[model samples]
Target: MLRFAPSPTGDMHTGNLRAAVFNYILAKQRNEKFLLRIEDTDTARNIEGKDKDIMFLLNLFGITWDNLVYQSHNFPRHRQLAEYLIQKGDAFYCYCTKEFLDQKRELAKANHQAFRYDDDWAELEKDKNPHPVVRLRAPKEQMGFHDAIKGDITFAPSEIDSFIILKEDGIPTYNFACAVDDMLYDIDFIVRGEDHVSNTPKQILIHQCLNYDKTMQFAHLPIILNEEGKKMSKRDNASSVQWLLDCGFLPQAIVNYLVLMGNKTPCEVFTLKECMEWFDITKIAKAPARFDIDKLKFLNREHFKRLNEQDLAVLLGYKDSAIGALAKLYLQEASTLNEIREKVDLIFAKKGLLLAQYKESAKTENAEILEFESQVKTLQDTLLTMLNQDCSKTEFDTFKSNAMQNSGLKGKAFFKPLRFLLTGLAHGPELSDLFPILRLYLKDIVRN
Candidate 1:
């Protein structure tokens, strides 16, 4: 089984959610289970109801972990493992006080060197302090592991301190709890952000001490950078899933865009099931991924094109069939739910079509009232006729030619004002694409 361990300290950021998605995809493709382990060992910082928020967000993206675990519930096991390491001498109790350590660190800094915990209690074999902490007995040489994306990553033991496995308060440190939790759960893979690369050595050391020279894979996903290439944070609107939901971005579009980021797949759009079928751990990019809002909007627009008219109507919250028919007229140009509603709402009440928006352009184009109005009327009538006749593209082409010839109008003078009448935009879906759907607006054109 694959497991995703997210700390419920705050709202679910896009980076953490992406990691959950990767693990979920891998497990689904393999027909195995994806497990959820909430790392809530730090109760001091825990916000009430944040765990539910995490689960809610997970389900929001359609991610369903097979097994749900609370790391705090496994605290006894975590402490038991730490004690096991101590009894085996793979870890030791340190009586080093915080003040003593700080003084040593400052002195080392002054001398232009790094402080190494020399296990000062080792030679003396004396319990010199009131509060003692558990520390791992790390190797003096290099510790190396194979990362799915980065290949081989090696860290010198000195580069890692003989960090605390269990705190003075008898609580397991994050690394200790995380490693033990994964092992206890028998997770087949550990997928997380590359920022946690430094923690791997410590976890692996703990794993080795437990005699679990694990075959479990470690896949460190790339970081998601902001527009400025800085790491994404709460300050970046794009990093918040809640922000996207509130803005009405389709969940499928978000999933599609996220899967494409740092993914080797050339595809720009996919359903969740399709993504599961195509996900490959080794194909994830080693480089950090940048979060581009424009890409997301593009995907959203692509999804808009695939929506059925009725579904589009429901999304726009329109109950009237007339508005429903017109709602789809805007689908081809709309990239968001709000945009679709805005377009339909414009035509819903005739008062909104005030025609005032056309004043400047109409004056500039002479409103082409006499010359272009007749031509547009002809085109509109011809489109209505085509829709009634169920005509082909060839027939529409013939009508377009006749309208242009009869109007003695060509270029912007002809097309611009006509476009303004059909839709307010100067540039949009081609007139040809609009013809079949034009039947929806015929009565309005005649009355206006």
Candidate 2:
């Protein structure tokens, strides 16, 4: 079995989806059981309706699961196992009071030393410290494990202390509940972010002490950071999936982009079916990846290209063929649908300026401007003729050929003035493409 478990503390972010995507892909590849497990054991932080948000995110990304499980549902089982460990001497109860523990921790911090729980609490009388918490009795030897992405990793046992399993509040700690649940469910493999790599050996110790008959495979993904190379928290996104959707990003684009973050190849566009067929866990790198928002928009544009013209226009909320074709020119390079809409909207404004004041930064000299106007004068008749004619999808080349031949000014010298006059931007959706739409108001521009 394979599982995609996320803590329902908040909306599912891109990093969370990456973990879920990997697990779902691997489960499909191996023809194994797959499940959605909500690790809602941390009830204090678990937001209401967040689980549904996670499901919505998974559905949007086209990752499905056969079963759904919540860590909170296994409270009885977790407590039972903790007791079982106590009986087997693999774990013991700590009778230290909250005050004593806090004092100990504060004393350690005061002296600039790490706090490790004293085992003397285990020997304390149960009558005096009745509300004790159960803790794992860590072994003294070094531990190591094979990770699918990280390769062989080793850790010194000295670094681990007697960590709590069952808290005084009767809830099992995340590590304990996770190990117990995976074992009980007979999970085949586990896929999680590399931040949890430190917790693996402790789980390994628990499994060994329980005398588990089989071992499961593990794959740890590298950390995904914000574009600035800092940790990507919920603060970076408005509300995770909703933010992306509001930005006019297609779900398929997001799924494709996330998978390629850690993957070896640059296959930026993929469907959910395609990902299931081609995604390989071993190819994921251990090095961290920065979440480049620009790249997401770039991939979105690529996916948008595959849409038919009608479908493309419908998505952009435009019905006019001239505008649709004009938008397609812009969409060809737009990273997001919003970019196309914003530019198109500006060009279609009724009262806005048509001829942009060329920025001093454009370094456009008065002599060069006059030269361009003189050259363009030769093509006024040809351009007016084009305005009267119908333009097919391939008509951009026809327009380009006539303009180049008549004015004898190709590339930037020819296109920049037209683009500036029409769209007020140095670069935009193809000029030939924008011209057909611009022809609707060409008298205004040509008259100016």
What would the TM-scores of all predictions be?
A: 0.77, 0.77
Off by over 4 Å in 2: 110-112, 123-130, 234-242, 266-268, 319-324, 347-427, 435-448
- On a 0 to 100 scale, what is the lDDT of residue 345 in model 2? 65
Candidate 1 vs. true structure, TM-score: 0.77
- Top candidate (lDDT): 2
- Candidate 1: 10-residue stretch with minimal lDDT: 347-356
**Residue-level lDDT tens digits of model 1 in 196-244:** 9999989888888899965878899888999899988889998988888
The lDDT per prediction is 0.76, 0.77
**Superposed model 1: Cα runs more than 4 Å off:** 121-129, 319-328, 331-333, 349-448
Report the number of backbone clashes for model 2: 0
lDDT of 2 by residue, 316-400 (tens): 7767555666676776657677887777665654222332334244466678766655544544544556556543433556767
Clashes of each: 1, 0
What's the TM for model 2? 0.77
